[model samples]
Target chain A: MSASAGSEQILHENTLYAEPVFHVGQFPITNSIISSWIVVLLVLVLAWSLRGKIKSVPRGLQNGLEMVFETFFGIFDSITGSRKRTLQFSPFVMAFFFFVLLNNWLGLFPGFGSIGQIVVEDGHKLFIPYLRGATADLNTTLALATIAVVVSHIAGVIAIGWWKYLNRFLNFKVLWEIPQKVIKEPTILLINPIKFFVGIIEIISELAKVASLSFRLFGNIFAGEVLLASMSAILAFGLPLPFMFLEVIVGLIQAIIFAILVLIYLHIATAAEEH
Target chain B: MESLVSIFHIDGKLFLAQLINFAIIFFVLYKFAFKPIAKIMQERTTTIEKSLDDAKAVAKKLAETGLEQTRVLNEAKKDALAIVEKANQAAEVNKQKLIEKTKLEVAAIMAGEKVKIAQEKEESLKEMKQEIAGLVILAVGKVIKEKMTDDKDKKLIAEIISR
Candidate 1:
């Protein structure tokens, strides 16, 4: 009987339980995907419903939406210092704000991550689930970061010349000094390789931007989810409520940070090079 | 050999899937959400500023009108005072002329009365001298007539005796 009990303990730990959603040939659809799609649909429906309802005198959701836009525009205007710039980039920034805000808030719903079923595939039972917050997934954060960084560079290329942006990577001005250092200090040949390697390192740093932005957001949110999960599992009664509220606040803050970081990156990328 | 699970793991497929999802979202959002709404917000800002400018202009006009009204009121007050002063001056001149005319009429009446009195006194004096001369002549004539009548009676008696 003790052997059976020990085996059951091993079974519980080794199951590798995950919320098995639909699989498209090993690319499993997750609850987080479902939540993101739901957010997309909800945003679409909301925009459609409010379309053409705009008036000289605002009423209902129009007033509320205008107030929010006005507030954010004021903040962005302060940052950008030109109404034209604010207007130009406001759509991208506001989209980030709403999508992230909705995703974060929806994570707080009851049974978001909890409600799932166990499904068996290839002699293994995995926990299949319906809903998870998108930001909690590393994939989602990385993709968002990639889009932000890539789009910012695109904007920079459009703002400044492409050659200037390329120079930031290649740094060809040091080429003239290479011969001087080679003759005076023969050890400079070794240093030149380091400099060449440093250019590659610059490329890696750009890749690191993707990793840092993604991990920062994912770490905070995933940690919050785990904290709530553990709290609920330990107490099962009333102790989890405060932590639940705290997770809600954390989720919102993470979403805001992600969006604002993206905006900052865009601002930096698009700024004119100083002489 | 022992194997430990790594806490940091990258799911490449999941990342690709998310990248596709984000790309679609960004495109859809740019098309549907960004264009019209941003334009509307910009227009709203312009409208608010325009209203504020209109209010400022109206206030400036009101202030100007208030100043002009005060100027007109002061002008009307000056005109009224000028009219009153002119009327007072004319009344003073008329009163002086009336006093002078009254004095001249009194003087003319006094001169006319003095002339009449002098003419009456001269006539009365002439009448008194004529009366006195007439009385003296009457006395002389009475005495001479009585002496002549006696002498003529004596002479007539002598002439009758001579004839």
Candidate 2:
């Protein structure tokens, strides 16, 4: 292949992070933020338009949306084992799923990565677009994960009392029970400390949950974006099409995984321990 | 950590904005979409259940009414049968009484007619005996005028009349 002078300027490479589109004061508004705002607007408009048309006997878009809600609620119910808890957690979990999924799939559109401005930085030209996959950025996923975990704790505090919910992580109640249970069973002295250690492990696990939830979604989406970019770079026409389809499935899976995990966390947090 | 931050360009501002975006979606969806739809579905379920229950109740009532109707019809039939039987018994008694009354009237009328006939027969017999005596007297007188009075003949005539 000969060096084509015209194709060189149009060639855009995928970056590891979202490039900044503009800045508001000290805050740099990245391309991912713009994409997220667009998703938010889309969700809001859909919700608003459907708000008036929500009938008892659902029809058209209401029916489709209800089916989606029912299917997702059923999955949530399976995780939570209670419709009450599913209802409580569904708003955020569904929001996260739709938002992440939309952001992921929207990135595969025609103008997302291709159309951008070339700017010279350190004498090397870099292509920066006005929009990118919101979930491809670490911050968006981190924020979603943080919100999910935090909301689970809040739900826990409300479901069980505050002290009881806190005891899952810092179990002074278990430590205090050691003396009381020692006289009755005599094996609790050995079991109680291990239980206390598990509580500490529980705290560590909560943090791990946040990290894993954020990273898994971020890594998957980012990888898919990179893969699509690479494929497009290789052939740009027929080769990227199949990968784009694959990315859609991947995007849906990742969204479901994230939502289900959050639902599980909510279920666990709200459940009252028998002991 | 600095390399990771620089490479990924992790912005706290963007994270906050995304969080706000999510919060807006959550509230909006919960208020406008999920809540109303769920409420409507629940209401529809309750209404359907209520309708089913009402139908069941109506069916049960219909069955009960059917049983009642049969019971009432049976009672009416029994009453009608009893009335018919009573009427038949009364009619039989009335017929018997009418026959007895007619027999008594006929017997009284026949007894009166028989008594009247016997009286008339007695009167006629007495009159015939007197006529016979008158004829005997006339014959005896004639015989006396013709011949001298005989004691023996007069005694015999008296004996015949007495016998």
Candidate 3:
């Protein structure tokens, strides 16, 4: 429904970016940020309900939460191989999972893409929804991915010593070992430089990890929203049902994929030096 | 880089905002959900293990008690059988002694009765001899009308009758 805010016509269109809902003293609060805040509030309310009621013998929602946590621990255990490591990594990793999953699924709620203000912008009316999918935006996914990758490096530093953790990317150790072991193993002359170069390549790959992680999640969720919009445009009714179902499944899978990839990076980062 | 940034509308402010949001989610979940639930799960596993161990000990003790009861019963049965066998042996010995004592008593009574019968026969014979002697004397007196007494003949007749 197009409503006139002024003489300018309403521009009902989907943009690649999250639209700003309002301005808070030069700080623009976008629809995606609103969605994320809603997710945060939902968690807070759920957490508040069980604040003091967390018993050893759980009931109802607590029981369901325990089951979910157990399942998550099991799945994370497969990635980390040790339950201790799983515990170390699970909080951050599951944050990603819950944040992405809830944001993705909740994006499909009513009044997300369909309801907004008809504001005159650039001599044209634009429809800006009050909420959008949090993970569907690049900033949110990029933030999550950057956090995941950066935390891996932190975990690496904590698990291994700083020097050992640092060598994974820059690899000054192989270079240092060259003068000491080159006499006994002459191949060190050739292999150490190559290994050093490989470490440099690992640096590039780390950047690639951020890009890939962010792009992968943002692409899938944004595409799902776009696909749903396209399908709704084609036929507003039952034609989009299957795609909605597909989007649901896709939301779950993409969340799992992101969480698992983050978990793997954590594992690889923290593992002890083999050689 | 500019093109990609423009295309995605990446903003540092929004990025930081989402980071803070994710931080809130993490803190709430970690403080409320993961830590307590993990603690409870660990406790439940511990309880289950302790219960299993207790059950194992109880079962073992039960088996041991069963064995002890059987052993006590078997020992009692064995002792009972031994006592009965000892009693039967004593009864048989007592019966043999009673039978021997009865045979001895009957023999002694028979010996005494034989002695009595012999004595009685001898006494009656003595009396008969005496009476016969008297009758001979009277017969002579009546036939001869005088006392013709012959002691040797009397003695000889007496001896022959005794033989």
TM-score of chain B of each: 0.59, 0.67, 0.84
Error of 3 at A233 (Å): 1.4
Better of 2 and 3 by lDDT: 3
For each candidate, the DockQ is 0.27, 0.55, 0.74
Query: Per-prediction TM-score, please?
Result: 0.78, 0.80, 0.93
Native-vs-model 3 lDDT? 0.88
Q: Positional deviation of B30 in candidate 1, in angstroms?
A: 4.4
lDDT of 3 by residue, A101-169 (tens): 999999988778888876767767688898899988999999999999999899889989899888887
Candidates sorted by DockQ, best first: 3, 2, 1
Residue-level error in angstroms, candidate 1, position B97 = 3.2
For candidate 1, write residues A47-97 as lDDT tens digits: 676677766676787677778778877878777777788777777777777
User: Least lDDT summed over 10 consecutive residues: which range in candidate 3 chain A?
Assistant: A1-10
Q: What tens-digit string does per-residue lDDT give for candidate 2 at B141-162?
A: 6876554345755665568788
Candidate 1 CAPRI-style tier: acceptable
lDDT of 1 by residue, B1-163 (tens): 0121223334566668667766656656666556656667668879999999999999999999999999999999999999999999999999999999999999999999999999989888777655644553456457665444546544554464446
Q: What is each predicted model's overall lDDT from 0 to 1?
A: 0.72, 0.85, 0.88
